[model samples]
Target: MELGQASAINFGDAVAAPQSGRRAQEPAADATADPGVIETSIPFRLDDLRWSGFHTRVVLALGITWVLDGLEVTLAGALSGALKASPTLRFSNLDVGLANSAYLFGAVLGALGFGWLTDRIGRRKLFFITLALYLTATAATALSWNVASYALFRFLTGAGIGGEYTAINSTIQELVPARYRGWTDLLINGSFWLGAAIGAGSAIVLLDPAVAGPDLGWRIAYGTGACLGLIVLVMRMWIPESPRWLMVHGHPDEAHAIVAEIERSATGHDRAQRAGTLPKIRLRMRDHTPLSEVVHTLFVTYRERALVGLTLMIAQAFFYNAIFFTFALVLTDFYHIPSDHVGWYILPFAAGNFLGPLLLGRLFDTLGRRTMITFTYGVSGVLLALTGYLFSIGVLDARTQTIAWMVIFFFASPAASAAYLTVSENFPLEVRALAIAVFYAVGTGIGGVAGPALFGALLDSGSRVSVFAGYLFGALLMVIAAVVASRYAVAAERKSLESVARPLATME
Candidate 1:
């Protein structure tokens, strides 16, 4: 076996041994004699697994985390005015903005803490634990008596959902076949918009005086978000752990058993068809890798890819948080649209976002990653600038402005979703989840925190030019990101994760 240079390590020739048959014979019981390094080949059978109801079930069960987050964040934005107007909790506009920031802050911390644990322990354990945290905090948020309590619960809720991003994205990438990975990730990430639409509609009725009083309606909204998590948890219990993670952790037998089970289930009792071929893998396992080595792998070994991931994450985070968090404010303060009716505008905006991924995701697999990602990011950024200009010059009313937003985000949504896919797929399996958390933290911290606060202040200033400037700033970031991606993005549309970034376990 020959290890390529550090600039780009090649796994092509690193498979030191290969057996003739589809499955290797069971190893000796004393295979764990020395824990320093253990070598084995657990076939990459998952890449070839046929799509089935099991895949659909897993996508829905695990992917609901994003939906819950979307619902939570959107609910907060929609109900900002109501929270301020409430006799029980009179939150200021800045207070409402701070609460949103608190949630994002909690998410950043959760991603860092839970992300490390996900890589250290296992995806299955952390996912269940994180979801429980989210459900508890969200349900508690419903009963908050004041700003402090609401902010605290919102932070805790963000923590749970933030942790979900690390665990869920890594799990989905490892489990789904390479061909389906692109579409699956884009659609799953895009589901956040579905939740946004639902949250908008819920706030509409819940905030109505006839439907429920001002005091009670807001509390019910928070409680309702918790219900979604409970249903997902039930479905998640039945899904198996990632075989890829198990294989690299020196449990080849367990990994093999799970993969075999998946194969059988995918084929459904077909005797001959069940014996499909899988990629014979060679993994060199280490009990623990120092943080220094992990950092080296990301920044030194695959530096270009790291740049691409960071650019994608930061750009999308800033663009999304800036607009979505402040959107209701724009409608209410600028256009005089009623808070309750804000849901009506959100429905169309959410539809455009949902359709972007559903419609454009397949092209990612066919046309390739770099081309499509660049196209989406570039187009969206350009359109956003045009929309911002229109808004500044008083050419766009509330309706036309929304139509413009719908058009802009239609391209941006899939591009944003692809940013997640980029990070998850471009890193090695050992530190995949942590890489996601690190980039998500840095990107969201810088972009997410600043974007909302800046825009909120701009909306309050009552100057069209100033608010338009905020939009241009976000637009510039996305365009810069597109340029970076064009140069550094990986052409990893249909490739297995191993092929894209070899497992840290692979060695000469």
Candidate 2:
């Protein structure tokens, strides 16, 4: 129950104790005290198994992080006008932008901080803890009496979701079978759009003057997000720690037990069908991997791969943040669409974003990571460039512009989701969570922060050419990232994580 302490979690009838407290003072070579080394072929055993009811539970529980994020983002965009109109908060247009920025800043910090703990403490503990933070903070947001309080609550909410990224994404990647990894990861990430659509639909109802007053409507919207977080929290409690994480941390007995239970759940009495498939591996179980070794793993041992991840992350962050945050402003300002009606347009856009990942996910495994990453990023970039050009020339109206955006994002969403998938899978299991945190923090800090600020300024200028130029800049970044991915993207499709980047402590 306490922070930084290990807790035992129950999964069905089996219980596994996650890593507890600091192992910092322990010597790495003391094999007898902490069980020196384990070489695990256990993960491959999982890779060979067929999909089951267990996998479904894991995906549904873990995948909601993205959905909650999408929902929050959509709500923020849709309710901007409502917030500005409210007598209670009396927020300005710029204030809404600042609140969003605060949330992102908090998320970046949360990812780094909780990400380190996820690698050090354990996965199961962090997932629910982070969700609780989101639930508490978002519920508090509904009670905000001023702009400052609202922004503070939003920051905490973002922090909770941001932490979820490191814990959930790493856990899912480690647990799911390699054959289904691409599709599963894409589906989970794309589920964010499902949240986005829900938020949009909710906003249309909540923002109506007849249904609710301006002051109460936005408060209810915040409460709705909090309620969803509570639901995810209950589901997350049913999930367990990553067995792969257990094996790396010198608990192979516990790891094997957990995997055996899953196998039983997956196979029932048919366990003998794949009874001998697990491979034996030897890995040195140090109480902790030194910080220097983590740095070496990410930047030194895998420098080129690290660059590819950074490029992809920065480009995608810029593209999504720049457009998504300012989408409503563009709709209302440039095309004269009513403020309250923007949610209707967002629904179709979210649908396009969701479908891209669903339809194209399998190709990441079938066609290969390099080809698919390039095609998606490159195609999306070109489409965005052309769309921006059309808008600048004054040939498109609100309906046509929305249609163009839907098409551009149909490809862009999957490409963006792949950026998360790429970084999470590229590093050693020892530092997977921290590595994801580093890249996410760095990428979101640089591109995510700058994108909105840059576009907000451009959008405010009300110059068609200026805003058009911002879109081209985003497009150019995506093209550059696609080129980087082509050259350095790991041939990781359907391969085990250990194979993609061998664990640092792998012994014989």
Candidate 3:
């Protein structure tokens, strides 16, 4: 075993050797024991990704997905006033709900469909295909001639959006360092809503016509979103392949190549030490395995992990879908804010959105997964329900509205990022992408369809105040999700991804 570099591990001096096959925590781990002899804090080939960098890319990608999603859905929000006022569109509250939901119903199909695509094909390759498809979908959304036509186009767009939730999250977790994974993933996830704020904010600004005649604001907003997605296609080129996936799927050489490049990135930086330290370093490359074996590893032995992904995804999509679809309507109809100032009011949501990952992410590790996520779900729900109720009761003055909105935004923040971290950490390298996609796709798809259906009914039949109570139910779902998470969710950050093992999962 080669040793004695300044960062090298000293076998005799280090703690008990790490067990075999435990995944590397961070590439920045001070030293490594060979995988055959020990497992904790092993090194990865690439070092530049700083787990944070990996998260940054994921956040950026999801941000685009979320922006496009917000854009696609906002067709309903942005044009609602017009649709409601115009006799031609003949829109009703129920119609609006169904239109909002149609996209989500399509997303349900999209998530499952794309999950299969990610699993069968490859994560990195599938990203471009999904993005391009969504961009085309977004552009086409601007051309809808009727409610049914609009709903059909939106549904297709939802599918592409579904692909984004699953694929980008899976890729980021596979590529980033473990130390900062939670923090970064949460930050990235929060940016999805920030993208939403962008979508709506842009809609607010672009509502005026450039050439006079009819107001082309909503269409222009969709166009801007589509163009931004095209820009995303170009930006994604810079990101490298997943080192973990390369290592697990018969690409050890490629994995090492990525590892070496990352190592070069680490040459000048300070190394992050592991808790209780380990033995001297030895570089031993791992055995290559077929994709079939990887697939079996996840579905067969790691079903519990899959459940975690699936359940949490459900919670995230349910709450998020409900909030995003309804909030704009709530602001305009219940509060009666002028359409122009609505976007400015939502800009603060960006603040709450950005804050979740940057600040609350630390609690995932510090407070531990069970405690933090449970609290996150509980608190966010309470706050959101209150925000809804406050808006309904006229208790929120303008300043108070922003404050309450900020609070509610903070509540919405954690699930987006926190859940991704959970999904990624729960599965092994071979099927990391697949697990993430399945989890998000199913959750979002299910939630997307159900949330709007329920809310739309409330929006149509009764006092507008009842709609906030419906939001309360959505928040309550998070509490249930928290229970599921507490019972089923394993602590991924405390351990390495490779260390994951279910009750019946004995390694060969």
Q: So what's the TM-score on candidate 2?
A: 0.92
Which residue ranges in model 3 land beyond 4 Å of their true spot? 1-43, 46-64, 70-76, 83-90, 209-215, 266-308, 387-394, 397-402, 501-508
- Tens digits of per-residue lDDT for model 3 on 1-508? 3231224542223222223344444344434443433221223322223444544554575456665665566545655654554434666766777888888877767766776666555578778878887888778877766778878877888888777766777776655665666776676666666666776667666654443112355556667778888888987886666655543333434444554455445454433342124322233333433557666766677777666666667777778777667655666666677655566666676677667667888888677777777778778778877777776777776557777767765856786567777876776554555566666666766776778777767766656478767777777877787787778777766444444432111122
> lDDT per residue, candidate 2, 259-365, as tens digits?
87888888784353353444444566655678899998899999998999999988998899888988888888799877678899999999999999999999999
Q: Which pairs clash (backbone N, Cα, C closer than 3 Å) in model 3? A: 9-280, 18-38, 18-39, 45-259, 46-259, 46-262, 47-262, 51-177, 187-357, 207-217
RMSD of each: 4.9, 6.2, 7.1
Show the lowest summed lDDT stretch of 10 residues, model 2.
Answer: 1-10
Model 3 lDDT, full chain set: 0.63
Over 227-296, each residue of candidate 1 has an lDDT whose tens digit, in order, gives 9888888888888888788777755556656766776788775322222233344456544557898899
TM-score of each: 0.92, 0.92, 0.79
- Give Cα distance to truth, residue 463, candidate 3, Å: 1.3
The parts of candidate 2 lying over 4 Å away from their true place are 1-34, 270-277
